[model samples]
Target: MNNQIDTLCTESWSCFKAYDIRGRVGEELNEQKAYAIARAYAEVVKPKQVVVGADIRLSSKAMKAAVCRGLVDHGVDVIDLGMSGTEEVYFAVQHWQLDGGIEITASHNPADYNGMKLVGRDARPIGENNGLSDIHKVAVQGHFDNCLPQGEKLTKGCLSEYVSYLVSFINPDNIKPLTIVTNAGNGAAGHAIDAIESQLASLGVPITFIKIHHEADGHFPNGVPNPMLPENRAATTQAVIEHQADFGLAWDGDFDRCFFFDEKGQFIEGYYIVGLLAEAFALRQQGAKVIHDPRLYWNTTDILASSGGQPILAKAGHTYIKQMMREHDAVYGGEMSAHHYFRDFAYCDSGMIPWLLVAELLCVKSMSLSEAVEKRILAYPSSGEINSHIAEPHKVLSKVKAHYSRDAVSIDESDGISIEFEKWRFNLRPSNTEPLVRLNVESRGCQSLMEEKTTELLSFLDR
Candidate 1:
């Protein structure tokens, strides 16, 4: 304990990332560090009352306890939500109108890693631009002020209300008989799915749920629940095929991001999902304003334009997307990365809401998931994001910019360098925590052109 305190007070914390706190257990994060972080958060935000939760990682429980202890020690009341996902913390903070919240999770990271996501009032993320840096400073120094009257601690559960609110997004009457396959990947999504399943049954929505790996196991018996990896997707796709379900959904460990697979066991890229959801919102509320990231948004913009919706572009990140959603009062905002934000949900992202909305759309449109997104996919063929490692990202970016500027019709550098032409467009942006740059190319109604441009852009890295 003494050694830990000395280390906390003397050393800098490498876990403080740009948007959230995340690192390997023991080496970068531990119980002591978690406590210091929570205390620092308390001193910085000074919330009267805050909610705390944790994912099913082995280290999460200990981390959450330390965090709660620190909060209470700083005279900040703590509301323990028990074992929950990142979005649940966001919901509790916003739904209960609490001062702040924290969820101990690494969200798709390996089992040896655990971290925390912090949010302020109304669940606004506490990123570097906001208050996370201040928290880091206090935590690293470990020079907290003398303890005041220790705040009380309490326990609460909001799963039922949260599921009810999610189901409220769609009319049960519109939902038709369907069979759906859900791959929880042994994460926290199963709990939410079970609650939603019961709610749908009570509402007389005749839908069958085929669940796989539907238990919270920190051991991750079936590997991590990250659907982004091609290897990790085969299980859900195979399950969808074997069950002959209408569609399938999968979520990460924290259940903040959701991924979809069609009835044919095809993994639909998230780029198409954004356009599908944008069209859904536009049809429901005519001329609805939708926010989208700058990366690979031709399909989204085209759909919004045709659907009589206004398309607003923001930098590609959850923090920026949520902030922009609030600024424009956008009804919905989506990142091709599968983070969906809604205005009614306190401008926070929810994995459960996106799937429900998509399911309802399937019933209302009388279309399969594949059929719903087929046209959009064809209209804008995209070379899903490709990443390249470069020693000096700036020099390569400069070269690419100079080379492309001559033929580029327009260039926007809001988030990264997005250059557009009459037939195709591409966005190149540096990774937040690596020497890599990500590139996404899309062409209007031309897969071959999109592929050609993607190859051309990738070759720039070799130069």
Candidate 2:
């Protein structure tokens, strides 16, 4: 879009996708770009102080240093949180009362990729609508004209406090008897969860835990920690079956989202998890506001509606939902992508909260993970996200919309394009995280209809 941008360099800036920034490391993302973003970000937010963190990417330390340099050079006091997950940076910004934060990560992207997630004061995301585009424009201009008195970079070791904050949220001792298998995929979550597990034990809850790839090996020898991928999640499910564990869990590279596998080695739909969290949050805060994406479960909507909570449908992305949560003072917001935001926790999405909630659900229900999730599946049968890659994702969406929108009971473009019928609903949205338009469908107590719609939608999406 920047026409006069001759040196508008980097690996295509594909990292600047729909949500946050992400791209391959040496190829597109590097210290120069990181510094550029940091300088521009400080100019926009005009923060007196900012917290910064980085994942375990081999290139992250240098990139983080570059980011800190940019901030400090612009008279922004830098509270370097050091190496941490994306959520930890979010935590430090609010928990430590910093003005804003930036986390260097590519999340589940391959080891060679890295990027930054910029936030405003109180850990709010800086999307294109808010200020990220301006930051990008500044970075592209390549010359920062606004340089104030150089500030200092101070180290803030808040991982201990971060661990404490997460532990305090859940009744660790009261957790139900259960077994959990998780693969951190050699990301920073391994270190954080290991610390939290100790806290859980101190609460007198003896949880049987099995962890695979529980080391900060950014090499990702076991593959990226993104459970959204079938191959990446295969080992996790197998581990659950092998141990007969209550459930299997996995996190992204920086642990911003959590995914689950039932005791039967089945991956539970993220929509149901959103529903379960909504009920839990509503019970604690009566008549609270809850936000949900309209992808897989109308049950989440219906449940929140009946649970004495106000249900609001949000566009399916972190940027939109978090702002809505803060505006409405929502107790919680959830997406089928497993992103969960808490109003009390600075309105930032967390990968850790869901795991703690699931642990509690196991204790309270006296049932295996499969048994607990099976009820929801029966309530709204789903067609798991199926993706098809073509030259043009929009062309495919347009074609699918032509067929489904004619008799549509409801139509939505919240995430992608969603068209609803009397008894079924399906959405075909291009993946910001990938190169395909994902198709997810659910039917109201009609397995056959669910299948029929799923087949038809996939057939169309595939083209």
Who wins the lDDT comparison?
1
On a 0 to 1 TM-score scale, where does candidate 1 land against the true structure?
0.96
Q: lDDT per prediction?
A: 0.90, 0.83
Residue-level lDDT tens digits of model 1 in 83-162: 99888889899889999999999898888988989999999989888998899988887887654889999999899988
Q: Of the candidates shown, which would achieve the greatest TM-score relative to the real structure?
A: 1
Instruction: Point out the worst 10-residue segment of candidate 1 by lDDT.
Output: 431-440
Separate clash counts for every candidate: 0, 3
Residue pairs in candidate 1 whose N, alpha carbon or C atoms collide under 3 angstroms: none
Error of 1 at 265 (Å): 0.6
For model 2, the stretches where C-alpha displacement exceeds 4 angstroms are 1-12
lDDT of prediction 2 = 0.83
Q: Residue 156, candidate 2: how far off, in angstroms?
A: 2.4
